[model samples]
Target: MKHYLRPEGSPPVNGYSHAVAFSGTSVAVSGQVPVDAEGRIVGEGDPEGQLRQVFVNLRTALAAAGAGMADIAKLTVFLTDLADLGAFRKVRDEFIDVERPPACSLVQVVGLVHPAFRVEIEALAVLPVESVQPG
Candidate 1:
């Protein structure tokens, strides 16, 4: 169960809500990079490919915590280059709901720990009691 909020005075968000509210157990997914379960990087010099791997990692993290993409209330996206914003949205919508998207914060940074990583994402999710067990 979740509710999206767009305060009257707030600027409209294109791909996400201004705020979200939900009542349930919460889980924090640490910033996920392009690396996979075996610690091998998937994409290099490819923002879209890196983004896909990032979302996959995010999904895995949520699953481990007894939650899924639909349960996410908020997301923080980091990219070294803002030019890929359009590309990011295209791939992100594949995983998250377009109508009931989570609140989001996207930002550009100088660089990530690894030069190959162009995108990283972290999420805060709320899980319903019957949906899953504890991690």
Candidate 2:
């Protein structure tokens, strides 16, 4: 995948690229947030609940991108509280298998979208070429 700024006239990218392109049979998705169906916050102040919601959102985003958990190669998480490690692992292991789990990263961030939010996650995936359509 090639990550690039949208374009000069396009909105500026702070640290992340405005767009990413995939030429291989796989796609890697960034960690998704815990926004709900109405695009509102869920699991306020609850790391475990919030992490679960992050997974759900990631699945939805991957589906829209023509991928799934089995296609994932890596999963990275960002959290506001390092003390939530236990909770994080509990939630992380739920969806991922031990045999060949994707590479993972967990970082402690100063803050997130809202002060109440405790976690956010992103992923790297490898979808079958036949399943991918160029964006």
Cα TM-score per model: 0.91, 0.74
Lowest lDDT block of 10, candidate 2: 12-21
For the record, the alpha-carbon RMSD of candidate 2 to the native fold, in angstroms, is 10.0
TM-score of 2: 0.74
Q: Runs in model 2 with CA error above 4 Å? A: 1-23, 133-135
Query: Please, what are the lDDT tens digits per residue for candidate 1 over residues 29-132?
Result: 99999998899998788888889999999999998887889999999999999998988999899999988999999999999989889998999999886765
Residue 29's lDDT within candidate 1 is: 94
lDDT, model 1, position 98: 88
State the displacement of the C-alpha of residue 20, model 2, in Å, after optimal TM-score superposition.
20
Which candidate comes out best when scored by lDDT? Answer: 1
